[model samples]
Target: MEKLDHIDLAILKTLQENGRISNADLADRIGLSASSCSRRLDILEKSGVISGYHARVSHKALDYKMIVIVHISLSGQFAKTLAEFEAAVKRVPNVLVCYLMSGEYDYILRIACKDLEDYERIHRDWLSALPHVVKINSSFALREIIDRPNLAASLGS
Candidate 1:
């Protein structure tokens, strides 16, 4: 990947603010011709800098009222054990994000569900059954202070 120029940074910053912005509008904002902007955008996508566009949907609107932070300690840190755990966690419906961490816990997961009852069902049916899991600690979020889905823009700025 080539080093991004000022124009490239401007394009990224603008796109991060509004992913749905039309190419013509984006060009106008970034002081470039539509053709030039389109070319740069194409390069950004092709080079995997701009991975993909997505809608930021509300979890509340989807009836997911609770976010559970789960810390999991695995029985073993072997490759096979980690892989098996990851594969199983991917299949779990309520699991929003799973991270393999270098801490006391082997893995940490962010889960979304309707309520306590819903989370209980998910825990009983899926989370507890995950491979190599020796310890599971769960914490319920009372409120969300802030959730930034756009961090790449900060880098450009």
Candidate 2:
């Protein structure tokens, strides 16, 4: 991948603020011609620096009121066991994020549900179906203290 410079950073920042912004407006904001700005953005996209654009949706507005953070420990650490666990987790629609981490737990997953009863159903059916899972610890988030969608782009320089 190509190294990004100040101009690239500016383009990234502008895009993050308004992904739907027209190329003409973006060029004006970045002090470049429309064609040059378009070319730079295309290069960024082709190089994998710009993955894709998305609209940030409000979870609360969508009636998703609960967030569950689950720390999971697998019984075995083989390749097959890991793959099976990941594949099962990927099939669950409510699971928002999953991370493999260094701790007592092998995997941590973020799950969304309507309430405690909804979570109980998910735990009984989905979480329990994964392979080699021995322990599952859960914590409920009372509130989102800080959340930002354009985190990576904001860090660019």
Candidate 3:
């Protein structure tokens, strides 16, 4: 990765706030010429720094009302078991995020559902049936206080 100068950081910060901001406006805001801004942005995108632009969609709007935090302990820590578990997890639609961890549990998952009934179905069908899963602990999130998607990008090194 290339070193990000102040201008690059400024561009990143602006883009993080509003991905749809026009190039000219972004250039003006970051104190760069239009051509320079465009070139820099192109470089950033091509180099995989600026991955993709997307809109923030609400899960509640999509009728996913409950967020379940799940802690999973696998049957074993073997490479094959872990790989199979991760692959199976990706196939489940309700699983929003999964993370391999270094703690009491092997993996943690964030699952979204419409309600308790929906979560129960997912738990019975998906969670229980997951490959090599030995134990599953789940907790419901009462409310989402904060959900920042671009914290890393905004706080550049």
Candidate 4:
């Protein structure tokens, strides 16, 4: 990867705050010409520094009122076993995120559901049926303190 200079960092920081900002607006904010800003943005996208733009939706609006954090232990740590488990888990609808961990648990999952009854159904039908899953521990989140989609500090904002 190429080293990002001050201007590149500025562009990234600005985009992180508003992904949908127009090229003219962004250029004005960054003190660059519209064409220059557009060229820089193209380079950023081509280099994979700017991955994608997406809307941040409210889970509650979608009727997902409960957030469940699940810790899972697999029967084995072999690559085949882990790959099978990951592939299977991806097919589970309520699973929002899954991470392969380095601690006691092999994987950790963040799930969204309507309520306890909905979670119960997912736990019984989907989670328990995942391949090679030996243990599952779940905890409900009371409230979300913070969720940052951008890396402001890392970008030197």
In Å, residue 73's CA in model 1 sits off its true spot by: 0.7
Candidate 3 vs. true structure, TM-score: 0.93
Worst 10 residues of 1 by lDDT: 148-157
lDDT of 4 by residue, 53-106 (tens): 888889999999999999999999999999999999999999989999998999
- Choose 1 or 3, whichever is better by TM-score: 1
Report lDDT per candidate: 0.93, 0.89, 0.92, 0.92
lDDT of 3 by residue, 49-73 (tens): 8899988888999999999999999
- Higher-scoring candidate on TM-score, 1 or 2: 1
Q: Judge candidate 4 at residue 7 and give its lDDT.
A: 88
Q: Poorest 10 consecutive residues of model 4 by lDDT?
A: 148-157
Question: How well does each candidate superpose onto the true structure, as a TM-score?
Answer: 0.95, 0.93, 0.93, 0.93
Instruction: Assess candidate 4 and give its lDDT.
Output: 0.92
Arrange candidates by TM-score, highest first: which order?
A: 1, 4, 3, 2
